[model samples]
Target: EEPWTLFTDGSSCVDGSGAGLILINPDGVEFTYALRLQFAASNNEAEYEALIVGLRIATQMGVKNIQANVDSKLVANQVLGTYVSKEDNMIKYVEIANGLVSGFKTFSISQVPRSKNKKADALSKIASTSFAHLSKQVLVEVLETKSITGKEVTAARKIRLKARQYEVMEGVLYKRSFLTPWLRCVGPLQAEYVMKEIHEGSCSMHAGPRSLSGRAGESQVPDRRNGLLHEMDRSKSGGNDYRRTSEEICMGQYCMPLWYSKRNNLGQRTMVKSSHGDTPFSLTYGTEAVIPAEIGMPTYRTTAVDVVNNDKELRLNLDLLEERRELAAINEARSKSKMTKYYNSRVRGVAFQPGNFVHRSNDANHAAAGGKLGPKWEGPYEVTDALGNGACKLRSMDETILSRTWNVANLKRCYL
Candidate 1:
């Protein structure tokens, strides 16, 4: 039986850097290369870049079987779909790596302990040195293995189920957790299978959030789907544009408390009656009955009539004109009032096309105006394509990271 060899490493320098990649077959033949990248990148980025380099080499060489390994927990977990990319730079790296994986015919990635991956580590350190340069040749060889298959159940590529889990919502299939090259390329059914395998311990599950040691408390399932249109949540956006029309408003705050209670029907009627009575324009009993002594006649004072009539006329005239037309003049004045293109700017944005590598900020607002980022934005992510108007599909430019789609607002173009 032919033994499989693993090639893995990273490269870096003070000014700029690149990742070093090496692939070895059972016979001890070595395939090596390096990726030259700009300076000031994180060590994790180098790891993912190295993985991409190795995978690229593997695909080109037509190696159908692989078991690439990395020492970085972040790179491994991310590629395995166990971690979420929170930093802006990380998001980009994740996206790029995902893209490369899909482009291959057969591929899978795993993370291993640093102590167990000395060869890849050595190659990475070598690439970071000043003598490091990309090798233009591809190397391959066949070799023997003491035991190609061992009792390393933990290293299996299938999803590993742990104690923690997510409940499948009604009617919703367990879609793949959008976290790999091979599973992503196969489509949704593979996702379902992965879910089953994960629950059964075949693959190592990342168990996001569920594994956190917290006292049993109320957990709010936040609505993650984009609202009514694309509006942000109230806590984040301050206002909701999807407000119900007043005609659809049968009740307000006061009615809500008892709205579903046993006395709700009676309570609502009483509240509605009280509201109607409190209005300024209502029938009032005169000091003396106007009709036959006890008969009350509703009286409208001249002053009240004049005020009501005048207000009604004003509203009628206003309703006849378009609000947009009226606002147009005001908007024009404001537009001209600003001397720059970015005054009182509601948002900052740029258009990105498919296949452009960009870094997505981990900030909730997608690198919104202020705050310190770990390394600011990081990526050489390939934009798979733009999704509608506000979101973009991204694959990690590096294979060591996971691939996922994100909103355009979260991304900043990588100049490099």
Candidate 2:
């Protein structure tokens, strides 16, 4: 019978440590697996772990014959009964590997150059890197230890129990809560980004952590209709002044927004805007403006007006104006939401944290030195503090804190 082939590799990084393996049956059907080693593990241990895991998978698949390839010379020689494992842990790993290999009717393992084992290496990188988000396609498992000697898994279980919350659905992990729906779990690195977004995002108020948490959780809900209704009831701003009014007026009057040297912006002030759903003049005056055309011809509103009638009608309009303002505010918020969504689709977000090195926009120092050709950014300053609202405190190489916090918009990360 043709022998199955297995390739194994391991990777370790600041983000995480993990192993990977590739299995190809005699018929050439391939299977790839990535093992996320949650426990802190050295590269050599990871190598052995990958081989052991691959062996177990092969055994379970009922493969009678298998040939394994590994990139690590030490692991390959030790398993082959050539170079002896001097360390206690290495010796145990060798013993465990031998036990798994014995199950196959025929088996052979050899050391191959790392380049030859690229597929396994690539898969290993997936587990070694911390992801901002995981899709349902990734198959995640707890991988309870093969034996009681697996202290890492046991310790992790204890730590999870203390948190008293969490669940895995469709291979994606989420945090459980008694009063609220599950919150998707974020990696330590991604958690910092989540906090920053909640603090500086458009919908956020500079409220305390409780408010931030509540809002962040609600953002994931499937339906926003209920929230929109609540927002309409609570909103009061009334979109009294639509910012695009001047732009729209200028565009309609002239092709470009030329600084109309002679023309006053009366058109902008009187025109209706979609966001506010009313004219600026109407909002400010609390009554429909008498347009020039209407004044020329005299519409019903203008014809019917008298001094005694005008005062009573204006007062009535003023009385019902509050309700209109609330609806306008809700419309303004919805319009802003659409704009924000479009803006975000084109922009990729960047996250910065304390201790990150960044270059600040050069002000007078570089401008005066080089005039028009001056450098745009300067200084590899260290981020000493990430103040809320996209602001940060920086320090120079000497380690003294700068006098003020800088906006992140004017900074770019300085990578070595």
Candidate 3:
């Protein structure tokens, strides 16, 4: 029997979370679903939710074979056993997906580009926004919670609050302190947040635990003075410090104040040398930046400018900019080629032909195989096709093709 083909997408926004599923049966029957989630969820979570629902729907219809497509690379990789689901919520979702896959005689899930899955994407967005307007043919379901068991939740809670002496009041933890009646306590999950806000921040003092505890008794004077000290210290430093201060002043003066912007930072990257041994900026602009000192006291390039010839020279430089850029590109490519050769010299390529039995790396998929004591390689899959570039398609001994290609690095020959 031909397998059912499924395309799934998910959307999560401030309004709500939703999932869309498009299932096509072997008989050419189509089933579409738009699920509006009542509970809060991330994009990846919604993706998994949609896939689980789609798989259940297929199983209910007595469909034994399935081919699934998802726009979420993480979900697709996790389902294909190429990526490990480390987060507790994600692990639960993966377990649920695995259970659903086991029920089917054959199943495969592949990652497709978002552009190709526009219909599913639209359905997800629509379900998240106006669920009431959805067609009757498009089934709408609500997932109240993720696939987490009460026992698992209880265990997680126990682990999170393990040996910590604190009392919960209105969803917040409070711990008794000698200095105060009650001190607000943070959980394991909140540690990073507290660190970011109060300690390890751009303006934070970044004090050691002992130092921070010592200063906890001080008045508000400490915080105010710390900020002053930080500012003063930054202003007083020399070398790169002066350059940073100048850049900051320029940004503020120009009203382009994005301190942590990556685009602004990329502008400061040093230019690589071209074939003529000139920096990219020098080759294009025909001159390097004139330092403040050089401007105050004239330098060779600053003093030697003739207005009559400057216009002509500027035009000539503009005309040669494309050639300079092309030369830089060629130089960069040659450097990359040399690096690739050095890397390939150390690499021992593993080659497998069609019909060859191989075992896949078990690093991520060992959870179901007794974990620590499990075999290093999980499969005795037969290579169905060589996908070139060290990738190959595989099928299980049961004649079920895998959803994605496996890299040669992750596979080894398995002699029967």
Candidate 4:
């Protein structure tokens, strides 16, 4: 016996959430299901919802052996026990799915990429959603049967009916009115509302009164205590510690952060940076910051602080400051070059030719939308021009050439 195949995909968007599923039996007939979820759900939740519904349908149809396919790697892995479900919702979803799988004698589920599962993916998308930014997006839905299929009915009733006055003109239902040539028939409640609005001349008839209770909440300032930020993450940098310490230091319960920040900043400036192997204070002021303890203890530098000698030393340091900074810049550049060379060595290079279609990394495009969802790569842009250098020009799907050229590193070729 051939195992029935089921494909499911879930869509969550700004407008609405929906789930679409298609089931194929041994007889090779496809039964497609499109569902509009009444309740609010995330994409993952909708995926599980669709799967559960599909499994329930297959069970009702008395299908024993079945193989389910879903595009969600999370759902597929969790069901297969390859991934552990940490979230409460996902854990519950896995449990529910496992229970359903136990009902069938031979049941298996596997994950497929979105491209391979086009039919379910098409059905899963709602009215307005796009993988990339686009002016016009198309969503395809195929159905085997027409929704309305019947011939027009002949008048059979002998009694005077309300339908006699109604007629369809340009697909608009109109009633034969005595006062007017054709009056559009409407529900009694809507007709009453429209007549009232017209008669009353709208004076607060349309927009209702604004209650003070609603505005009273807005008038009061929100409780800052309730919205207090929690320090959840700890940074590895010492600068964060300096900032926190500056905030904590107080004089008689009054925090003198500004005074504390001066010391912290001086300490930070004197601290040796790994990049240039030198202190920022020395690089800026042409001399290291002398500690108060060093002055009190009479160090060699403090003892040598003659007015004439100090002036000459300061002038000499200032003259050599430019040379010191030039060395620092060279060191920083060398370090960066070493890192870049190492990175490039490990990376396998990808080259594009003319007429080649590629996807630019969607990092910048989707950085604001930093969620796990959405495509990581943005286009199927065509390569128009390529220079000997790593720079290239691209053309969009509309055949419009982009003004800005991109580095070859950012361009990834489309496999298909």
Q: After superposition, how far is residue 341 of candidate 1 from its true place, in Å?
A: 95
Q: Model 4 over residues 139-163: C-alpha lDDT tens digits?
A: 5589987655543222324224766
What TM-score goes with each of the models?
0.29, 0.33, 0.33, 0.32
Error of 3 at 361 (Å): 91
Ranking by TM-score: 2, 3, 4, 1
Deviation from native of the Cα of residue 381 in model 2, angstroms: 84
RMSD of 4: 35.3
Q: What tens digits encode model 1's per-residue C-alpha lDDT throughout 1-416?
A: 45345657665557455576668876778865555565666677788778877777777877766777777788878877899999888888888888777765556677677677776666556556643444655355777864546655554533356312222333221222212101011122432232223222222232322221011011211111211111123453324333434343221111011111112112222111221221111122111111110011111222134564776765654564354344544555665666354553856657789867788775543434555635556565777777687777777755543455678777788876
Candidate 1's TM-score reads 0.29
* Candidate 3 ranges with C-alpha deviation above 4 Å: 132-416
Worst 10 residues of 2 by lDDT: 252-261
lDDT of each: 0.50, 0.69, 0.69, 0.66
What is the lDDT, from 0 to 100, of the residue 117 in candidate 4? 83
lDDT (Cα, 0-100) at 286 in candidate 1: 11
> What shift in Å separates residue 397 of candidate 4 from its native position after superposition?
69
Residue 65, model 4: lDDT of 94
**lDDT at residue 271 of model 4 (Cα atoms):** 55
* Candidate 3, 106-148: lDDT as tens digits: 8888999999898899989998888766666755599998899
